[model samples]
Target: MSAHFKINKQASMLMWTLFMLMAPLSVYLMLKNKTTLIEWVLFNVSSSPIMMTIILDPAGTLFSSTVLMISANVLQFSTIYMKDDKFIDRFTVLVLMFVLSMNMLIFFPHLMILLLGWDGLGLVSFILVIYYQNPKSLAAGMITALTNRIGDVMLMLSIAWTLNQGQWNILYMWETSAFTWQSVAILLAALTKSAQMPFSSWLPAAMAAPTPVSALVYSSTLVTAGVFLLIRFYPFLSSTTWFNQTLLLIAVSTTTMAGLSAMTECDMKKIIALSTLSQLGMMMASMGLGMVNLAYFHMVTHALFKALLFICAGTLIHNHMHSQDLRWMGNITTQMPTTTSCFMLANMALCGAPFMSGFYSKDMIVESSVFYSNNLIMLTIILFTVSLTSFYTIRFSLATIWGPSNCSPFIKLQEETSLTTPMLALSLMSVISGSTLIWMMPMNQEPMTMSTTMKIMPMIMVMSGLIAAWYMNTRQIKHVPLLMLTPMMHYASCLMWFLVPLSSQFTMKVPMYISHNYLKSLDQSWLEILGGQGVMSSSFMASNSMMKTFNTKPVNYLMMSSILMLLVLATM
Candidate 1:
């Protein structure tokens, strides 16, 4: 290799090494003395001359640690999953970029710096999602990029609006403006970034990427960035009643819709994608209802289980030459026993089986939703959504693991290696992390206190879902036509698609028209809108008319020329 090539290679290696090291170091630091480690990390984080400060509160520490652990595991898993890929250097670079940005996102004090990290993450995710460069993957990447950009614009606007309203200082701004229009703007940004209803179409499409990219970006990092943003700014949102209510409605709608959609999806990746959307919705709902701690708690737990689930899925798909359709996959439990077991554990967590990490976090969210909203309607919606979550998670498991053998003819089960280690670790974490909530989190709160009604409802929902999933998977119950059985849900998905136009209608005129004609347009017209016609049309017309008038005023021009000559002669 040339000298320049050598230098580039070394730089890439350094970046990869740094990222791999950060995870273990972070865990060690936390374990040594969590308080001191948090204080030190916060000090470093706050040293940046930003408008906000990084405070090492219990919730922040927990979230930060969870992100660190999952990012590390995903990076490790990627090493094995991407081993045979051609663009290994580029892949590693994006992985490092993702890790760096996520670290900054968690520790940054100011909203601006946080946004910088946020947008960086989105860029890296878009690149990873398009790593294959196939037409379909490229399209998926572009959609994800554009949708995330829309969310970013909303965030930027919120920041600008906040500054415009004289909320320059972070603490003061949040204290004074938590419940204002600014809060609504911020909430909208979060909703979009988290892929809540109407903004959720991009997520399912993103499954075109490699399984590791899906595991890392969609499962753990990028998808949850919005939820983390909301948690980071919880103090600001605490006072906004209307914003809170709106968030609550969005969350319920998203969770319910995602759960129903997951039931319809046969692709393993799409099932996981919808699961992520639903899980994120649950987090948002908790935050909307003023359960910041619980929201953060759920985020941590979800990250662990979801990452594990995705990694296992990646293992299966990779071993089988990227066959991701669950219907084509069946009864690999005998061949890939280790992988199957890990997946089952993660699935149990995902379904929120009792005593798993997912159960605690999910129960916390449901309990908090009931306590904070105190609306039986909201509670019922959330409960039903949880049941659907269980059903789909079970559906995913049965479709992939319990059906007749469809393992690829050419592929064989290989012994587990370093690549599979991360999956195994994550699966164990999913099973055990629930204990963290019981042991660490404050359970004295109303939701955690668990009244008789609260305890009974969650159990009933869980049992009902488990039974329902069992019946469906056993083929004892025929699959219902979504439109016939759940007309409202069918319409809700349609409504989500319909709202795209309605929202576009209110936001901008030309872009809406172009988006409506997106794929059909011979050439994109939105670019023309940005090329200055909207701003220059009237001015250009007026100038042309003025030129016409001037041409008609030839006598006036001659008089002016005569005056100029007279003045020149006088000066001479």
Candidate 2:
């Protein structure tokens, strides 16, 4: 290992430590300077305002701080988790690039400069997801990349729309009609980046990446990019009815599907990944409901616990001989109490347990919807989604942590303090970040004070999920309860309501089929025959026939003799 290679524990830890310490300076600068633009003067001429730009805005700073904060911890965690792998240096470089790209995307509020980060995340993610040499990893990388490219296309269209606005800077054009289609374009683009609705399956499949990548990217940085973008562009969105309605529809649908799917899922990482999907949907809906502060609040708190959950799951899988099946994991608390406690705490935070990080954000999101929205359907879905969120989270925690000891006595799991240290750091944050953030936030003028009935609704919903999961799982002996195994519902949940097929079998396949057959019928066949090969072959055949005629010297001689005879007769 090189001194700086991630395989070297001290070197990797040292790097992440320095990076983590530096992240807060950005938050400080944003707070102190308030709205400021840093630009490259060389790139701008007096005639045109077009130039490279970086923004120091509150939203951009919040996003930058959250990404680096979570990533710094993940990077440290990776040093220990990936220590056995020889390519840790290469992997570390990829991870560093991933985090750096996120910071750029957040810093440059201008669409032109921001696309650098947008495109960077997509490109590097393809490389990182396919890091393991296997077909599954390759397929996962393709789905992740191609889905993101759709957003990239939407962004290009957005850039073109911004041309109508006379500048590349999105911040400058707010409160104008120029924001019309540009906002819609940004909304759709953000949808793809966040894996909303039709694109939702990619997030779970992305678990094929190394657990550390999942912890850093899917949970905190990459998937959150879209929500972060929406949070930035939210001011312009309030007047757009269709945009708000569309976002609300997609967010709630994703939330319901993800929560139910997590309940049915057996793979630990997939379960956690699905929970992330559910949380992201909530964040999206929060933005739709005109509570961008609450959305940003949930996003930061979700980052802490979500990373903690994934890392703890990764530890269990690492010890269980890389088996991620919940069937193989049982009574983890009995053997690895430290990891178990961290996992439990993280799970509680995810469930928005009382006074925890998620409680401040998640609870408020549902409750505030009362004052923000009048639509009954939207309100019902949000509350129901919260209940489902609790159900799956509790189910997952119970199954793996205290269900039953399904493993053999022969395998002894190693206890590494380094791995747990990162989990502990995040666990502590999961307990404290929300309390600090709500106070630190530039909040709405006042809390949407609801009746005691409305206020306790979220807690009641949480309790229902807890009781329901306990009653159902307690009765199961060797097999899962048949109620949970309902054929149609289970099928939908497990396969993500046929979204994977819709994306792969149809969305992915139709274009691939057209391209493949087009290559066979056109580019590789008749087009080649007509364009390159056809022209060459036809020229050669015609030239060969002419050459054969020219090679017959008698034909040339006869023509010369006839001319000679005509000239002789004329002379006579």
Candidate 3:
């Protein structure tokens, strides 16, 4: 017990020490020298005898470094933000675990180690989601946990498939020819982890957690794990035409559906959640097109801005005593100027405005989709997605920062120091992180410049969507018939539910009857199918047959007994 206690204490100290070291180390690496955090870590690992060196190509280095830098900053932010929270110790431990797992995941040379870190982070995220322990929050946490577990299973299957093909090594798996089944499994895992399409039902529900948990896990790390896996396994995915095609379809569908959902959402966190799903879709599409560097660039920028936005939203909610509905919020620009400013800056970044971090990375993705392989379908889908991206971004910005103040009368509010400090720091990062991406890691490829005509299209799309939103929302226009606008488009939103069926179909073809009526019988025979209907029934029948056979052998049993008695008398 004493030894165990000592080890626990040591682990706690090491966790804090690592965080303290990494935060300063990341800044120094990024600022003093232009070397990214991933390169530095990889260099050190390469030099170490015990730790196997994993050499990162430019794309891998870029992705890993960005994750490291953002994670470091968030960890620093958490120290201040979670200071006054009741479960500070537990929160810190999970935060440390998350950072450690992510870092190890990106850096590990072995596939097994990477999987360990991958699953560890997912588990920690689920725990953090339920940290609040409220009924609604717990329910949401369960959904998030279970959904992620499905992703985990898919990932494990991919790994097992790779191992079966004698590709146990991480690097070898990518280089091997046995990637088709592995890629399919990995893609399913990615779709679920990224909260794409039908699997996305858990994400909005996850908003029941505290805003910080949502910010870190949902917006940045946990959700983006899918994108990371895609990029990391890009070679395998790129090798398969079917994999790329499937990924592109899913990405486009997810982007369109999530953007529409974001538009309709009234809750601040839900908007962010839906926006997260949309952004992930964009990243996945980028990866599908073999634009790994661009995807990583966007992931980094998105993480910084999204984390800032969520923290700012949390500040607003915390000040308002947990009211997250945008309708109840108004004119807080003056009261919470720091948070409001942060929110606006982050929103602009999300919108992919010119010169912003999101703009550069997102434009690269769109341009890649347009130029790659002469596929007009990919281009059109991406173009439409870009428009919706801007539209929903504008909607989210307008709902949170624009319009009349509608503060509720009954709710008492106060700004806590613990919350505002993180919001202020994140706000500053949101503006400056774009410059870091542009200047620090200047792309070898020439930057794509948008023509006046090209620029006009996206702007027009944004404007039209905003106007439509205003028209639909206004009391005078609220009564306008839904048919006047795009009635077909509205109905298509319900088609998001088809994602569940589509993904299931990808795995197995469920009978129409089973798919339709399964819910009605979910409570009854669901366990039988899952547990062991065939095996249990067979076992019961075998036991009954054996009992009858034993009874029928009574004459043989009596004969054997008489023989034994005669043998015993002869011996006497």
Candidate 2, 194-259: lDDT as tens digits: 999988978988888998999999888899999988877776666676887788889989998888
Model 3 TM-score, 2 decimals: 0.75
Stretches > 4 Å off in candidate 2: 1-33, 44-46, 174-178, 477-485, 523-572
Candidate 3 local lDDT, 1-572, one digit each (tens): 33433433454455445546555544454444443222222222233322243444444444455555455445545544455565565665676688677776666645555778788977888888888888977877777887788888887887677654433444555545556777777788888888887688778877887666677777667888878877777775677768777787888788887876666557888888888888898888877676777788888888878888887777777666678888777767666666777777787778777676677777667765654564677667677766666666665666666766677666554555546665666667667776766676546565556566665555455566656655555546546534336755444453343453354444345575677578667645676656688568876797577667676577866875697689889999
Clashing pairs in 3: none
Clashes of each: 1, 0, 0
RMSD of each: 8.2, 5.7, 8.3
Which of candidates 2 and 3 is the stronger one according to TM-score?
A: 2
Please tell me which model should have the higher lDDT, number 2 or number 3: 2
Full-model lDDT, candidate 1: 0.72
lDDT of 2: 0.82
Q: Model 1 residue 433 lDDT?
A: 82
* lDDT (Cα atoms) of all candidates against the true structure: 0.72, 0.82, 0.68
Best by lDDT: 2
- Top-TM-score candidate index: 2
Regions of model 1 farther than 4 Å from truth: 1-55, 164-169, 174-179, 371-373, 442-453, 476-572
